[model samples]
Target: MNNFIKNLLLSNFNKLLQSTKIACPKENLHNSNRLKFYNPGKVTYDGKLNCGITSYLTSFMLSYHNIDHKVWLSKYGFGDYLEDHVHITTNSGLLIDTTYRQFFIDYRSDGNCDYYKYLFETCEPIFVGSPNEFDLLKKSIERQNIKVFGSLNQDIKELSDFWKQDINITPKMNLYDMRKSNEIHPTLLVEIPSLIQPLIT
Candidate 1:
């Protein structure tokens, strides 16, 4: 990594470490109020908090700051179970993981969780080079390749639709289908664009 990028990552890392508050609840996973706690407003008020919430907040911050990046998910197999971890990728495909500190915190607080232990030992602040360099650290990581605002627009719409369904009823759309769906409300199309201002020539 170049000195500039190294310094940039360190600065951002320190800022996030000092400013962001941890919000992932310690108990009652199923009965917890997810929307109330994990929404953008709450996250902004409390910090990124967890993997999924952190990824969304980081992505939004990157866009607002005019940083060229994409959010990527890394899936790991722990015996019969698979878990997804989210991080960010620069325009050059470099990896940036701002919330890695949480893993260390969780591991130190409770060593019983094997996943956090593995992550705390393995994860680094930034991957420090190309996507291939980052890939060398983790096996079976999936990059969403969402390099532009347009890519996120559809996924956001599908997510909105999925959430609109009845609480007891499951949506007909599968996870993959919802993520890749293209149809969106025209009125909501301006949301991302407004956050990311156009570059001046």
Candidate 2:
């Protein structure tokens, strides 16, 4: 990646981390408590969780720049827990993780959380790692490379069709802190981002 472009990606991702809130519930229709990490931008509010959603947002930005990237799923997160760990590697030779602090810098409970009443943002959520961190992660944890994409489009129709359930999303404060303010990402208001990684698409 060009220095300028890498800097730009970092700057924008940090802005999103400090400015946006994710609507990821403890329990969704699919998994145990994950909001389909690919598209946790809905409502229910979480920060330290959903690295995949963070990756999607970052990958979305990369895609907007016409940068190709690949998504990967880590069976376990940085900490020793079965957290929803998913992130991306860009063709620019950068490993970007906007939601990394959730495990490394913040507190993660073994089970259950009260996100509605709690503010999970303790420190800055931006983390751009070199090959070292990526190498360490590879040796320690188990993960799989899913798919690479030139761009990812929101598929709300597909999710709605498959779920066929009423989404009772409660509002919350800044999770990623993109600071469109009052709620979440400005883009998320209009375009629903795709989930982190569903079993199928």
Candidate 3:
């Protein structure tokens, strides 16, 4: 992707991100223990909470704009066994994750989480910039010998279908409708249902 197109995609992305209703629950924000995660001066919401919803909105934006991309589903690093996270890898060579702060705030700080270090390369609010960077993150996961599903390639429609079932959202829902809904917490959506998995032999 040329600089012009990349810049344009980035511009659109920032606009959508700013317009989207991403937020932290008021109660959580008030909790002394969880207070640090919600920075009132910058964004009142929690990044960890918006991870999934923001990803799909981002992917669809790319598709509609004629930008080629692949949505990647990964183990959320913090969830019930059925959980997985979503992100985008654009053909233009950009790796996107709008809610990366969530990873650090949600898991990295917990020293009691013995497996936390193994789950992610850095929970320090950094993003994977390119496919090569993404691969490094994957390598880190492998080096730790984690058994989680690192990431699976998926189509937009498949993810949309999952959302429809998980949150009464429609597959054909447009970006405008999605943005109008303000915020749809990922916690309310289940990525892959256990029933959808085939039994092992």
Comparing 2 with 3 on lDDT, the higher-scoring candidate is 3
Q: Model 1 scores what on Cα lDDT?
A: 0.37
lDDT of 2 by residue, 126-172 (tens): 54555576455432221111111122212211111211112211122
Tens digit of lDDT per residue, candidate 1, span 79-112?
Answer: 6764455666667556665553332222122332
Alpha carbon lDDT at 88, candidate 1: 64
Work out candidate 2's RMSD over C-alphas: 16.1
Best by lDDT: 3
lDDT of 3 by residue, 144-169 (tens): 33333333322211232111113312
What are the models' TM-scores?
0.38, 0.42, 0.43
Which candidate ranks first by TM-score, i.e. highest?
Answer: 3
Global lDDT of each candidate: 0.37, 0.39, 0.42
Could you give the C-alpha RMSD of every candidate to the true structure, in order shown?
Answer: 15.5, 16.1, 13.1
Worst 10 residues of 1 by lDDT: 161-170
lDDT of 2: 0.39
Q: Which stretches of candidate 1 lie over 4 Å from their true place?
A: 1-5, 22-49, 78-80, 99-124, 135-201
